[model samples]
Target chain A: MATEAKRTRKNAQSGIFAVFREQEAAIRRFVRRISPSSSDVDDIAQETILRALQAEREREISQPKAYLYMIARNVVRDAMDKKSRSVIDFIEDFAPESVSSHEPLIEDQVDGRQRMLLFWEAVATLPEQCQQVFVLKKVYGYSHAEISRKLGVSVSTTEKHVAAGLRRCSDFLDRRAAESGLNETRRRSAGKGE
Target chain B: MTRPEALSADAPDLTSEAAAWLAQLETGRLSSRDLAAFREWIQRSPRHYAEIHRLAELSREVNILAGMAEPLKAAAQRRRAVQRLWSIPVLGWGSLGLVATCALAFTLLAGMPDPAPAVPEPVFLVTPVGETREVALEDGSTVKLNTDSRMEVAFIKGRRNIYLEKGEAFFNVAHDAGRPFTVYAGDRSVTAVGTAFSVRWTDRELVVTVSEGKVAYGEAPARAAPSQASDAGKVMPASSAPVSSPRTMLGPGHRLEVSPLNRAELVERLPENVLSRELAWRSGFLDFQDAPLSEVVSEMQRYTAQEIVIADAELADLRFGGVFRIGQTDAFFEALELSFGVNVEQTDDNKLILKSVN
Candidate 1:
């Protein structure tokens, strides 16, 4: 019985690691999306993955990627909530003078600006209807029904436009990140999708 | 890339499927099976995860852009104006073409229709016993309704109004300065432009607690102005007659308690620990800090179908402090009996009575 339990634990650990190997970049991106600070993004992503692994060890996780996303979301929410309370720490983190680590604060700022510009350009490249739908639903926080009513389109159509917009933006960024060779880990997983 | 269609050879079907999942998941109504399937789909390819992550980033970027772009803000304003105009009963079928044209031109025009209309028929939202629900309003606001609560939602151009008929609800009002969000519980209404607050209406009293931002809590509009009362039966705006009733503007960590007998609204700034304990219902845990036995019983009654009653009046004032899961009341009773030297007599009719130890 002990041997069997050990074997099951080993299997669960391997399965969880496999999940990390496959979805780590995506999970990191998910965390980065919600995190207010770029520096916290990596920490939040690591914590999210670690929590998921710990949770999986105790019980079965039939949907590991979904579980990972959920954890990442919660981690972001907790970070934001904490940041709201510690206004001084938040200000210090943004300031360059507070940096004790080797990571240059200026690089992060430049990277953030570059990313924002890339995102805006990608959005501009979308079809007119898709751009409007994406802006209304995503930027303005309108529900699908509201978007449909405002745009004089069906709800399904609004969703389709949003999907198209998301696909274009994702493809644009992924390709750019690949070309720049900035995401070496992401490159390794690129072939695994096939 | 400029054409958008040429950006990826990745099947449009997959992206659209992910979009459908995103839409469904945001509704807060996905089943466990759907969640499992979504996980499998996302894990099937790194590309899938990339798309979802990009969707999130795009959403954030759009919000940022919304702040920067004057036209986008105007579009939202026009949409609200169009919604208000559409709700008018007097503008019948003859104005349909004009309304359609106005909606189409919402991007061009910045503003119109300053006044808000009376509340039309409100849509009722209810949560049965032991069931907590999160409802996303037409406006970006969200309401997490506690167990056994009922609320009426009325969305028009001017303001977003929610009437809590009975029970407790937490409102996360989306920030819209042009239109204020108000939650009316019994005779008191909690109003805010952008804030997070909870309102609990019980037979004993009405309580409003602010978790984030600022909220004004006071008596509901006692009466509407005579000029605004076009119809006798229609629910007019509560703010119509801004009588100088005692009002309390509470920030974070502040709570307003109004009891039926005591006409004075008690406003208190609780410490962080105590404030969290008070709002623990937002999570699934109930945190009690030296609360009276009677108060604990009332709080527990909101979550469970079983009624807890103190048989002896003396035991009602006995102070108790502990953290208990909302769903597990039997464990709470067991702990009370073991530690506090109380006898629990549970009858078959879902009644639990606490008596002094013999």
Candidate 2:
């Protein structure tokens, strides 16, 4: 509760917010480099920056970049922990192979998890503006009119961007599916071998 | 390439086309031509339907993302000041430490000058069964809480938010262009600038009826279902993007009814007279126009602890219409028996069972 109050107080300060906006692009790119997918870059960056701010408030941080990297590392670890718990639901439809297996079937899950990350990574490959519009409309829950106003674009433009994002993301996924035809073949062979 | 394709090769083109239709759906104005075209497209192949379903799933994913935005925004605002301090390499070690110390002092002093506005904690109000309460908010808005309803009101820095936890409430919101007022009910949110609207939450379904002004109603991240009908029976231009489910704005005399179980949404314009009759509870009256026996009983259940049931399935469908005072259940039963020829049997456990007279 004390830390929550402290974080709230720090958030209310304009000085920290100004610095955050200035360094946002850099932080985003940093996260993208190490991120499993672009879809999670913003999230990891946000978490890293928030933790860095908290650490800065607690003590003097000599090397801020190193501090940020450490925070991102921790955030990623936490996210992985959370993902493993819910990964079963995500892989339920994709991995019916687990049902036939007698042994604890751990290796098959690795492939399923990889495909799941790939699906989201394909979403991260969308053009910057398109991705922003998609995230605003889909993730941030902004309406077309609200997105138009926020992004300084017309309503028609917002709609176009959303459509473009959907097309591109779906195409990326399809392309990945086509390229990974071997995976399907291997899985089928594995099933027949059983 | 050997296996059956999950999506057709033309999936991209079809999805793009589906995206256009999805956008058109959100505009709440589907022309007969567009509707016919969409139907034709879907009937052309199962692939088209599959594409639309994927689009809907994607939209739901977006809604889930919206749920995480509050925390993302808070954390995204806090960036390190070390960038500015460390980027300047020209300063010697002594001056570098001096600069860091000054920066620290400036940061601490920045918040000391002015006091921030105090944000009031959210206040929860509840109404017991058979009771209705009216409350005036700090902004001079009024909320009339209906029987067995609960709501929480929070007025923060730049927004007025009300969470409709259970039942129904009629809101007379004060206009503030600087801050929007939003009512969160279930997975949907109804936002208004200045409007009189009633939001009812029952069995995980949300019913929003607007009496005055226009209000936006929809699910998070635009995953909302499309409006079934246009406002006041007047269809806007079909060229506009379709508003998705759980999301749509309604004008005066417009109502949005969403049932998640079936993912069905109905947005229709009503006559002022009909709207008034449907919402007669505001004036302490129960108005029914050929309502079924089951519906009438459920309405009665909200007012009292007494349970009402129809003994025969056929009796449940018998329609009854009348206007009666809220507490006059005895009169309601007497009139029903005399006109509808149904026998009312009261049990010792306060259960009223309606049976058809043979």
Cα error of candidate 2 at position B300, Å: 2.2
Q: Among these predicted structures, which one has the highest TM-score? A: 1
> Second chain TM-score per prediction?
0.60, 0.59
lDDT of each: 0.60, 0.58
Q: Model 1, residue B139: displacement in angstroms? A: 1.5
Kindly list the interface RMSD, in angstroms, of each predicted candidate in the order they appear.
Answer: 18.2, 20.4
Cα lDDT tens digits, model 1, B1-358, are 2113432555756666665665555433458897778667766655555544434433334343322121232333333333443353211212222332322212211233356455444567777776555555656566767778876776656666777777888887889988878887666678899998899887747888898999987667643532223334433346434422436789998988887697567889977567766766554446665677789888888888877889977677676655554455665786566444468998989698899653
User: Pairing residues by index, what is the TM-score of model 2?
Assistant: 0.40
The DockQ score of candidate 2 comes to 0.07
Write the residue-wise lDDT of candidate 1 on A1-194 in tens digits: 55643454467657766666666776675455345446777888788878887897798876454456557656765554343234223222333332231222222333333343345445555666787877665443455676777779987787778767777776666665655554432443343232
CAPRI-wise, candidate 1 is incorrect
Worst window of 10 by summed lDDT in candidate 1 chain A: A98-107
